[model samples]
Target chain A: MKKILRTHILLFLLFALLLPSCMNEPVMPPNTNEGNFEALWKIIDTRYCYLDYKNINWDSIHDVYKTRLATDTTEFEFFDLLGDMLAELKDGHVNLSSNFDRSRYWNWYTDYPSNFSGSLISSSRYLGKDYRVAGGFMYQKIANDSIGYIYYGSFSDGFSDTNMWYIMNYFIDCKGLIIDVRDNGGGSLESAEALASYFFKNDTVTGYIRHKIGDGHSDFSSPQEIVTKANKKIQWQRPLIVLSNRLSYSATNDFINRIKASPNALVIGDQTGGGGGLPFSSELPNGWSIRFSASPMFDRDMQHTEWGIQPDIIDSLKVADVERGYDTIIEKAIKIINQSN
Target chain B: MKKAGFLILIIFFNVSVYSQTRNADTYLLSNVANTFGFGAISVLDPYLSPLQYNGIGLKYDNDNLRFLDTEKLNLSRQSKFTITAAEALNPAFTSLMMLVGANYQYGMYYHFQPISDLKVLAGGSCDVDFAVKYLPRNTNNPVNMDMSTNLNISAMAFYKLKLLKRDVQLQLSLQSPLLGCMFVPQTGASYYELFLLGNLTDAFHFSSLHNKRGFQSRLLLHVPFKRSNWHVGFDFNMLKYSANGAVYKKDDFGLVVGTTFDMISFSGRKNLPPSNFKSITE
Candidate 1:
């Protein structure tokens, strides 16, 4: 009986000792920000699933951060540091949080209009081609003329080869082609090159990619080649008018730049979105990834289009024009083609 | 006739004494139980023996050590120690048991240094490591690798309830870490070092109730799968750290095997000598 009682006491003591340790609380670090972004950064550096890009400086980057925290006064500076740190990783798919409303940028883009002078045909089919309508940009043929009129919404669908080919084919037999790229927030660069190839008979240098090294800079040329097996035949040799606006970006702007360089293509729109650089992605220690622009792209003319691409013929739109449903830009293109005929 | 009656009374008294001893053995055997046991063996040197008599068992074993890859950043090795104890609160209610366990681990890593900063803005050239070779320009030469330490202490309390005729056991555990820390450089120059600090600084605490409910039945074959006289089981856990706010967790399970000895005798059977045979016993 004494031995059993002793054993029970020992078990009770063990439970008493362990019970307190089980309900432990997380310890908050002293004098630190509410969210520990620094700690998150380390986690990414060590355990990211993949590491393809090279040239990461661990010490100097840390030193600069410490210096920034010590000397910087406002939260904006800290945000800038975070943004710059993310940019150093040089990937294009990552993004970070911002105090500003990114939605406002999209709203501003959707409200903008194209600057072209051509009237679109009312036929359901365009040059014997059909298109799917989601939200913006409708293409159709009009009666009494073989001209194809297209209303472009945005540049987000640059990765779709079918859409690019459809637009190109619709203008094959038209007397004049009206291509719309207004209010397009740029997407894929390869898509831009694919669309531009339809207009070129020979191989051409599309643009240059600028990468940053320490304090210096280097350039790599983005070359475009014609897809030989894509039924290499030109059915459209008519005048081509491209529509643009101030909201067009990266790939969209590149498309405009390529068309402007060609002799047969005419751009008629407002200034395009000034973003012409490729983005880079960085992984944070906290297991979150961020993306930002790391390089700028330039045309064959050595012209930097970071401030937005200007159209050959500038035609701005007013709010009243949208309410009337009368596209003055399309009307002007039709008039020009009619006069030439 | 009187002599014969006296002999009969003596025999009856002796029989009563023997019955009393047998009853005491049955009562004690019913109250006492062997709940669980655990053991493990690792391939990494120096070898840690699984036997408890060698002073290297589940409670005190620390022979194999490896780096904890948290966020793939700070590479460090941790030494862990664990001890577990359990008991039945009520012998009458044999289905209920209480378990308590404690775990402590200490880790350390060598120092890391950052080399160069690549400007990603404007038309700048991104550093190509294969094409360039450069060293730190700072006065204090970057430490090739210096040792840094971290520690984690955890404890758990659980209540296990047996159900379905003791075939399944359900356990509810409250777990928490008492100590957690990571060493950071004074100058704060390396991102890898900063990454380590973020993961190790927070002590994790939580409560989980789990049913280790598995169907365990005696097989009617010659295989060892037949219900054995003794059974043992074990659980292992692993924690992974990530810098980008992600966490990784892993676990391993093991079982124990042995024979059990019966402690009670029937009414008319004689008390046998304790089995001293070890070699030929199997």
Candidate 2:
């Protein structure tokens, strides 16, 4: 009887010992100069959301960059080469953050007109000294209280539902509300969604979001619906004009996408600098950080917006208007509001 | 597959015990333990942050031992659970990153006495690991997830001696992961693709010594009073797992303190005196 117990115990131990042999092949990429280069290339190749849409020849890009790699290449030089490789994707969300510098692509706004002039706004007394601050938004009555103007500079700053209630209530008497998001580089999605929800009375299916699921570049999961529910707070039912420019990006772009469906809303300004993908970060073998768009966000029509989103009514900044201390884009929106009233 | 493996192990043990000679005397022993630990952890995901963190943890352990032969062999099982919170920094130590983790393990052992004062045991165990690391200020890729399951080989030793004319028990044990499966995104894959999209292909990785290995060691001491005994011990644990160009490691050392109880014992013969096993309180 004791011998049987011993035999069973031995067999159990043997089974335990044999399990290790079944492990799958390792997927660890090497850590070298060429290794780091190949690693970055492969990551972007598989995970970056806009490769096919943007029509980038990733393999050709790899061939061009591989010649620059050497065993003795300096870390700084290697970083430059990697930065250049990433720039080919022409995405602002893609960056390489390091102790010395953070690489970026800004042609989304740089090559276009600077449709916003901050100095002119300050001098025009449009946002007077008494302009109230509601989270990231600064607001006041403009054109002699004929129209309500709210300039949202960024989405990073958070505001409570109470703050939104106060801002919309203060503008309740105005002919129309102008949401000026010029040069508003994006921040939090939650903040953007919260503000956008105020314009809708029902649950709105704003867009679709999907991410890479496998190692293959074309591998992706089914698109998930991105719904923006109506705000539980005070809703804004007045005529809404959303002012945008080349610098209105990321979540700001998402905000415009949300408000576009509103019948009372009109998007007027230069084309918006679009960043329609959610960015995720990674690291290289050398410990340098890499940030790239991992998930693709689409418009209601399921069209890609990585390049830029077209304005319903395109309006470029006039130097003449700036010199006269008037924002031409704001003037156009105010005229449209007054004409409608 | 994991459930099936667990059931097979249980059946194997039950059959082994049933086949053993029915000793006239048998005893059941159990103990509960609490441990507090401090440890350093490093996580390297080429697609996430490449920094290490340090943090504190709390652990709880429960052990049940049944002796079939007072001096020869016994069956034992241990369940341990732990939770940890840690942070990571850059070379300057100014930038901070954070992680919170939890682990639970269960081991079944068969003990045999090789010498008069020493008892050795061999066994197997299963463990589950879960963790989430958050970078306080990272905009896009701010959170990383770590989770896995492991089947391990475990061993233990016990010794009894007299200290200052009082009987004392000393015990040590080690458990090493031999085979397992874990969730690993390909070098650049995102959780959205794998979890939300159900891209499970290559998500469940087969892990072994080549890609994952680790050991946990525990040393415990038991002191007797008039009734139950006082238990105090130290524990050291280390684990390293690397796959898909990512590496994760954990090192922890802790102090344990608890108490022991003799829950139940049934003898085939009548009126058995209290157990004579010196490796644990009788």
Candidate 3:
């Protein structure tokens, strides 16, 4: 009986000793205007990857934005103010979504010339109703039956294997394939990789991707290389011209970077809109949604492409050419194809 | 949290004197329970939202204990596994969050009997907990991952009595986490940064009373039948941890019903000790 009592006392004392060490301090700020402002500032300060690269003094930006936040500020006003603050990043992927409105920075494309004309492609360039639509691509023979023109408008769209195989077969007899990905704001990485795989004869290492492992700006994992091997079922061995414009972004930017590595591929048109970072979502205290780039992606040389990917041949649309119902970029691509052959 | 631990210890200490003896032939016992109840959840992730939600929870527990052969020094090894899922509602923004959690615990205890019908078990346990809470509507940050591994002190009391011409058993148990480590990203850190970039600073943190506190308690009742026992119970569990300026708290209480059975038992004169040789006629 004494032994049982002693054993019980010892166990009780063990837990009593542990009772003093368990209080934890709360980490989040209160849900007020000042608190929300600070939280937003901290979210970007810690999670946004481009602060150092973009050479923006985020501390000063916070100082400027905090002055705009008043106790009487309306929800829309606060939303606009936050949008203004994010605009400094000049990134298209950074967005603040609310029930009222969504904030976006579109200068990445709006400030540049619109090199693509949908009407011109439909009326004159796509062989005037002779083009066939297979999956997300509109393809036809151009340059008097010598060049294959394939216009892919968006990466958000998916295409089946059969669609791709048929498209490749249709272009099999052409001199070369002109792949136009203009105004494609990007979509699935799997789709992007699948499309890019066709240009390679062998396995290709196009770029690298790394995400945040900790809170520090410099805290990142070792870069994981992205490999896109050729799909032997319907590989494109002929000369390939990938046309891109300022609106080609995200996965489109990635496609351009990958295709640029292929020996038989050449990029033509304006520099692509850069959206190299993979975006993720979070929310503010006010229930407003926030989306920003979380992971950084790189090109084959491990260089950041968040700003934009430069084309091998820099060419802009000529107003006169548009008036004459011709695509300057497509014409240039056709010329290059003829010269290379 | 510490106050709660102290209260549990005091209650168990007072009940230790009435410990009852258990059948020497019993070796392995397995218990399983399924429960459902309502609880409250609070999350303070600056990237998500700062709101408290009330929701329903479903839980299940499986425990196994094997007693060692000893007279004065009675001992047992126990293993327990638990799964819980909860969905909460917040009227502030018409928002909701779903959390799914799983845990496993293993420990060894000293079993004691100070009276004819009461038994006390006390020991230390190590637990690993992993949970994920997801908000379907949050745009910027939609998910929070919760994970921790801790060493805890545990105590249990078992009481057996005859009621209505049938044998009944009642048991109460508590476990308090003492020390361990947890993973929590910084206030503004994203999983992309933590998982993809591999930035683990402040991610693996030491947990103690200052940064974490929680306890699990349960009261179970058993009614024996011909070959097995039908069990019914209530469980209350609370967990709270704060690190890198992010706070996570979960409180759950539910009614449980299950069954218990002995997996292996010693029988007859062959497995009995020589001291029981004359039990048939003496």
Please name the candidate that would achieve the greatest DockQ relative to the true structure: 3
Per residue, candidate 1 scores C-alpha lDDT tens digits across B164-198 of: 44533221111222222222221212222123213
lDDT of 3 by residue, A257-278 (tens): 9999988999999999999988
Please, what are the lDDT tens digits per residue for candidate 2 over residues B1-282?
Answer: 864465457423322332333345544444455544444444444335544444455555555555533444465566677777766664335356676788887766665676677777767778898887776545566666778888877777778989889999898776777778887665444554455434555567898877886767788898888977877888777667667655666666777777777655434556354455333423
Q: Model 3 over residues B223-249: C-alpha lDDT tens digits? A: 888876777778776667777655666
lDDT of 2 at A81: 86
Model 2, residue A51: distance off in Å is 2.0
Query: For model 1, how does the per-residue alpha-carbon lDDT over A1-341 read when each residue is reduced to its tens digit?
Result: 44663474356446434443333222312223323345434423432211223356644666666555634345555556665655555332224544331111232244455442233222232322454442335666542447777665555553344555675575567687777776566665555665555566665654444333221222222322212112145424567778777667767887887777665678876888666555433322222233334445566666666656788887765446544654555555666666666
How many steric clashes between backbone atoms does each model show?
57, 3, 29
Tens digit of lDDT per residue, candidate 2, span A40-145?
A: 8877887787888888999999999898787788878878888999999999999987788888999889998989988766654578678889887888988888
Q: Chain A TM-score for each candidate, in the given order? A: 0.59, 0.95, 0.92
Alpha carbon lDDT of residue A144, candidate 2?
A: 85
Tell me how candidate 3 scores on lDDT: 0.77
Residue A257 CA error for candidate 1 (Å)?
Answer: 1.2
Better DockQ candidate (1, 2): 2
Which is the leading candidate under TM-score? 3
